[model samples]
Target: MSGGCAVTLDDLTVALRALRLLAVDFPHLPAPDVDVSPVFPEWLRLSLHDTSCESLSAFEQWRTALRIAPEAVDSRTQSGGRTRVLKAEGQFAGAVIVLTAYADEPAADRAPAGQAGGVR
Candidate 1:
């Protein structure tokens, strides 16, 4: 974890504040699936799964809210052409926040449950 910020109580506080902002600022969107890692460089990952347009829009909104540079965003198609993921990273009050969204694909192309679903 070299070059990573050390996790601290302050980082958790920042994460909570960000969550609150999401709730208040974007009420139309569904609750995001969230993940918090307490290891070095503590991070919070928020994700949504829906139509490509919706997810992509959510990603854009979050990236703007977090003030992440547009150059930081990255997108790639999955191996099977079932879905694509767009990701971006930013720092908020010493906490790393990662925003991701999965674009939906045809139901028949999806993998079985408990298998290689998507990036976690």
Candidate 2:
């Protein structure tokens, strides 16, 4: 494999591992598969069919896109002062996408408060 392809594969592996961990934390949700392909302009593709129709869906889509195009590192500032960093895999001019998946905060944290009847 080319150097760029190697980087892409590494990125995919990292993202997939992350996703698997996220799945353990959030067992109710289905984690998307990370796909890396040179056919689509050296971009990686992340995809999930069943998920919430709100911001979580959007994040899933973005995460998939970022994983595939791991070279485009971007930061997304979410609510509750949470920040997500999407990192790319290869160098500029020969970068490739790396797709990944993560469970949303709401899905991950089963209980926001330590006691019963706490706010979500």
The candidate maximizing lDDT is 1
What are the per-residue Cα lDDT tens digits for candidate 1 across 16-117?
Answer: 676666677777665678876555335678897787568778778778877899888886656455687888899865667888988866677666655564
For model 2, the local distance difference test gives 0.41
Tens digit per residue, CA lDDT, model 2, 4-28: 5344555444434544544565455
Weakest ten-residue segment in model 2 by summed lDDT: 77-86
Q: lDDT values of the candidates?
A: 0.72, 0.41
Report RMSD (Å) for each prediction in the order shown.
6.5, 13.2
